[model samples]
Target: MILPETTTVAADEWVSQHRYLRDSGLRFFDLLVAVDLGDQVTEVVTHVMSADATRRAMSRIEVRREERIPSLVEVFPAAAWHEREAHDENGVEFAGNGDLRVLITAADPPPLQRSAALEPRVDKAWPGLYEPGAVSGATRRRRPKPVPGVNEEWINGGRQ
Candidate 1:
């Protein structure tokens, strides 16, 4: 079924309302995907199957990046994988999910968004003694200068 576009259902209600479709032989929980709108909100889409081979049903749910949405794992345990993928890729939250941290790595940054500076500064200054290619004998090797004191060390470390 095509759900209401703007309707917001309680987490439990959302799952309960769809349980019948599952029991009616809609055994496939195809995918759950989200699109990032560059703000705190995302558009989530859930696809399911019907008994008829050619028929399909989609239930869409909008979720804020900060807030949690209903988890479909209770109805279709297969949904857990899709839920985790949505959470990882688009930063969607699935409330009462069995494993919120699954399929996510600590090194992965949060979802991308527009801001004052979208690109990073590529030309930052650093102190090092090295030439573009090879230094000639006439060109004396630049002495390795100590970075002023501990303050410079701390600043560079923080940037990294």
Candidate 2:
């Protein structure tokens, strides 16, 4: 199996780098996405391939959570949908996409961001008072644990 060639570029050079790749024969736009890197930064990645499928490449740009990267819609029109999905899910903006309407959940802080609190998973009361799978009203055997990746203070109504 062949792996896609990966290139990490600065946010300002994103469009230009992709344009170079497209011009070099990786003209097939595969996908675009965002990965939440905890509370400080997010990585936006794009993949493109040659027409014959023999060559592929991935481009990545890491930016602060609030920063916006240039859009690739002018270079690859199909990037609009993927960009919108990345925007809605991770709060990363694709500047100049023009059609970045929400493609998924409308939750604040973007559901996929590492700092986002899963309210439903943390707020709902479990039937077992003491522990999961235990009988209701059972005596406490241990301290209740907070949901993974959710701040305990936040779940308790205190912001940290």
lDDT of 1 at 91: 65
On the 0 to 100 scale, the lDDT of residue 77 in model 1 is 92
The 10 consecutive residues of candidate 1 with the worst lDDT sum are: 113-122
Which pairs in model 1 have colliding backbones?
none
By TM-score, how accurate is candidate 1?
0.59
Q: Which digits, one per residue and each the tens of the lDDT, describe model 1 over residues 55-155?
A: 56666666666788888888989888888887776667788787867476432444332211212222333434345566555563664455543233333
Model 2, 1-160: lDDT tens digits are 6767688998778889989999999999999878987757998888899999999999888989767888999999999899889889988887899997866688898988887867764565443334657777776678566555545555434432
Clashing pairs in 2: none
- Ten-residue stretch with the least lDDT total in model 2: 121-130
Name the TM-score of candidate 2: 0.78
lDDT of each: 0.62, 0.81
